[model samples]
Target: MKQHLKRTAEYRISNRRMSKSGIASLSHFLYIRQNSLFDIRCWTFDVRRSLISFSILPG
Candidate 1:
């Protein structure tokens, strides 16, 4: 019974530590994802605007 209790306590401590790190990494991943998506949106918008300008100039 004592060994079982000790093992459970150790497991709980490790789980808590892992959860904190997991949350940090998950948030970091989301931040990077959001920035990349924003960059892609701006790039596409710029490309479309330049294409429109070029087409207008030719006509």
Candidate 2:
């Protein structure tokens, strides 16, 4: 009856909240992962450039 309806509403609200938080956390994780990958790419590029310069200087 009324109590059952109330319980159902509460359950739905909680489920919606959980899904929102889950999406937020997932996007946060992806953002961090993307930044880390970009950093790694930059680091690798810098290292390769330095190596080329060093080799040219020796020659």
Candidate 2 lDDT over residue span 1-59, tens digit each: 99999999999999999999999999999999999999999999999999999999989
Evaluate residue 36 in candidate 1 and report its C-alpha lDDT on the 0 to 100 scale.
100
lDDT of each: 1.00, 1.00
- The C-alpha stretches of model 1 lying farther than 4 A from their native spots are 1-10
lDDT score, residue 40, model 1? Answer: 100
Candidate 1 global Cα RMSD: 2.0
For candidate 2, the clash count comes to: 0
lDDT of 1: 1.00
Candidate 1 per-residue lDDT, tens place, 1-59, comes to 99999999999999999999999999999999999999999999999999999999989
Quote model 1's TM-score: 0.71
Clashing pairs in 2: none
